[model samples]
Target chain A: DDEVITHAHGAGGGQMTELVDAVAVSQFADAAADVGLAALDDGSVQPIDDDHSVVVTTDSHVVTPLFFRGGDIGRLAVSGTVNDLAMMGATEPLALTSSLIIEAGTPQTTVERVTESMREACEEAGATVTTGDTKVMGSGEMDTLAINTTGVAVVPKGGHVPDAGLSVGDRLIVSGTVGDHGISLLSEREGFDFGGDLESDVQPVNDLVRAAMDAGEVTAMKDPTRGGLATVLNEMASKADVGIDVEERSVPVSGPVSSAGEVLGIEPFDVACEGVVVMGVASEDAADVLDALRDNPKGEDAAIVGEVVDDHTGQVVLDTGFGRRYLSPPEGEQLPRIC
Target chain B: DDEVITHAHGAGGGQMTELVDAVAVSQFADAAADVGLAALDDGSVQPIDDDHSVVVTTDSHVVTPLFFRGGDIGRLAVSGTVNDLAMMGATEPLALTSSLIIEAGTPQTTVERVTESMREACEEAGATVTTGDTKVMGSGEMDTLAINTTGVAVVPKGGHVPDAGLSVGDRLIVSGTVGDHGISLLSEREGFDFGGDLESDVQPVNDLVRAAMDAGEVTAMKDPTRGGLATVLNEMASKADVGIDVEERSVPVSGPVSSAGEVLGIEPFDVACEGVVVMGVASEDAADVLDALRDNPKGEDAAIVGEVVDDHTGQVVLDTGFGRRYLSPPEGEQLPRIC
Candidate 1:
């Protein structure tokens, strides 16, 4: 572990995982003792009954400029937690708890606006904020607002996906456009007027995940939040001891978003996506999974972006039109506090 | 509602309640729509099986100094969430999730120390941190560190203490010394050293709460956190529509802790407590409950400090040696970020 934590350590990039593994995860002595935390999926699932298990996931949102073009921290808090559970193969989202730490002097209208957005997002995800706590700090003691959301989802026994379930020859799919959220928020935070139709793609993806699960067997699943698509695939490859190969042409990226990244000097794969899921499925069922994802609004642009391979075990490779290049995880906080 | 948020709104005092009701709770359109959030206890509980229910509580700890004499944020985060579940009558703490929002440049040693404390506290409470998330903000974007923990616990069917379960003939009990946590943190933050032994009473109280439940029927239960004892009693009275009469002499306060509160110009009742529980038990079972509590080390100083009465409905009356005086809930911000 580094002597001091850097901004990159929290950037959901390669350093972020290293910090977590070294500082946070290392301290938990029993995390790997059959408590279901060893998988390190977006969420953790524990058995609550013989026939069902409860999925629990939490995320603290310190996103700057609480409000963006498409969503606010309120919506991000709920959607992120819901998506975490969905990544764990939770089919039915149940109850959620919200905790807010607001900086003094924040406008009351902003709180209302954000909370309304939260309720709308919860409604969309088929969940409710059953309990919540709120605290306000001195003006300079905090940012505008920080929200933490914890969600509980109930799924049938033994029906959830594991992060380490990827196998050689498994197909990898990108739910939709990548890097929309990161690019949109970075533009807003830095006062960059792309002056185009760029908005965050932050939303609940439980429906899309449900559709994918119903279509075929999903061996592994993840939501590309802080680390973007590249980091998540790298995590899957590292955790499952497999290799990933992606066609540069097949990875879906909107023209405007790609252009924004190019102008910002940030790679599209190194940013974040608040409303996307990357999945690993059996190669034989890839076509069916893509068809099912395409049928949903959230996954209308879903594509089979890559596949698991055995050649470069525990590494990711990108295939260009003429050559191949290794895809390495971003080093440090490429985009700080984007989520 | 005030146009701007204030520090009092997060102080766990009367103003905090008002803000929560006006902003956060009001925006939750369906919290009371049969989702099990309407009870408004320490935590919201939902049934997981016909024979059991799961209790979930989330809290954000933003204490000024990350480390204190008796405990640090890590212990506070784990204990606080565990205590919330215990107050809800959850006897068996199951799993917990920790989310950390760290400022860039925080020392890795500090991170390791805090997480180690968290693990120790979890082990004491018989719970595990099964899952977690970490986010790092820019150096100036956040305070030193903020930790949020959400805990899940399972309780047998019909074995919880409801906030609205108080009756006219019930006796109120204080588990142990109050104001230790609030006063200790305040003195440290303000650079006051009485030169005597003073430390925060921050520890896991699942055992104390479990013992109280085993002793007798706990009509109502709550931990005197941000709002203190008087505030918690007032909440119980308001929610249950009963009167509470507290005996000033019977309330247990340590010599140094009480003296510290007196010097700081803060009421013993307006501050916070990290490891105490207030219970309303039936009058006939009060003796047995006290005996059972006294049998445990954590509850050795337990006392019947008050009682549920018929007069002064929805209010609290403090009985001094000379006369009786009305005890009102604190108005605002007794000690900012004193979690």
Candidate 2:
């Protein structure tokens, strides 16, 4: 491990995994939890009784530009936790707790805007901000503001999904276009104009997930956030000890995002998509799941992008029509504070 | 409201209340919850079924000086959330989620020490760190580190206690000394040598609280963090629409803390106490509660500091031997990042 922490250690990549495993998982290995720190899943599950389990997830949002093109820190904070719970198959959150640490001199209007945005996001997800804490630091002691949200939801004891539940016969589906959030934020921060609409796809997709679950089985699920589609595919593959074969043409990327990624010298697959979910469905139910996802406006661009296979276990093979190549998990910090 | 936020807005005082009400409570006012954001309690309660309700709380730990005299940020983070759940009458935590936002370039050793401390605190509380998120900010973009911990617990329906449950004839009790945490940290930070074993009382007090609850009826409960005992007393008084009369001599302040408070010109009552609980118990059960608390090493300094009254409603009157005066909630930022 590196003697000092760096950007890579929190980039949701290989280094992040190493750091988490060395520090947290190793220390908390003995905790008795149904789906705990060791799983490295989107959330943790604790069976409350024989009938139901409690699913909880948390995220700290430190996006540099508090307000971006399509969302602000408030929306991002609420959606991030809500989506994490949804990924664990707890689509309807019971409650959400928000904790804000603001730097002195931040405008009251900024805080108000962020709070309103969070409320709107919660409404969209059918969740509520039930409790919260707020603290202010000296001006130079912190960046403008950071919001951390923790969400709790209850699901049937055996109904919750895990990122490691994929099998060789499962089909992979994506909720929407990829790379919009990271690329859009980067372009906005760097003063770039991609010409076409390049707004972040940072919205809560728990409803979309619910529709898909209602229509078909989702054996495994994960939100493509910090490390984008490539990272999630690799994680799902490696954790399940299966190979993921992705069709490059089937992975949707908007014109503006693709062009912006090209100009910024970043890969759409390696960046991030805040509102997307990469789900593994049973082969027999993939079409129904895809249909259900596409029926919602948030998932209009959803696609059946890949399938799990036995060969090349623990790797992701991307078929780009011309040739095939391995899709590796993102390695370092591609963009900081893009959450 | 101030056009721009200031340190007072996060000081757990009058300004902080205005900020939270204006920004969070009003925005989340319509959310349906058993003990929602409007209550401004230590935690919130959501009825999951006819028989069970879930309690959740979150706190963003931005305490400076990652390592303090008796506790570090890790222990503080876990204890803060655990105590919050305990205040809501949920003594056994079901799970805790930790979110770490670290500054780039922080030493790995520092992170390791903090993680270890957190594990120890969890073990003390009989809780587990089930899920978490890690993010890194650019070196100068954030302070060394900030940890946000969210705790969840389930209690039987109608079992949770509220901060506003106090009534006339209730006796107020302090589980331990008042100012150890805040005074110790200030002396350590400023190089003051108040060398009579001054150390932070930052430990999980769920077990202590459990013993108190098991012995007597605790009508209201709160931990004295931030604005400390004075602030919590004011909040409880105002919320419950009652007055509290405190015997100043009865509020326990250790010899070292008292000397430090005198030299530093800070009121021990106005600062923080991380491991102390201020409880309002029915008069008939006060002795039993005090006895139960004293049986625990952590609460050996427990004292019957005050009593609820009908006069001076929404106020806390202190009988300081020769003079009686109002004990106002601490104003402005007496201490920043103390918790």
Across B66-176, the per-residue lDDT of candidate 2 in tens digits comes to 998999999999999999999999999999998999999999889999999999999999998999999999988899999999999999999898999999999999999
Off by over 4 Å in 2: none
Candidate 1 structure quality by residue, lDDT tens digits, B276-303: 9999999989999999999988899999
Give me the candidate number with maximum DockQ. 2
Candidate 1 local lDDT, A165-274, one digit each (tens): 89998999999999999998888787887875688999999999999988988999989888788888889999999999999899999988888899888888878899
Give fnat of each prediction, in order: 0.73, 0.80
Cα lDDT, model 2, residue B63: 92
Q: Candidate 1: where is the Cα deviation over 4 Å? A: A31-35, B31-35
Residue pairs whose backbone atoms clash in candidate 2: none
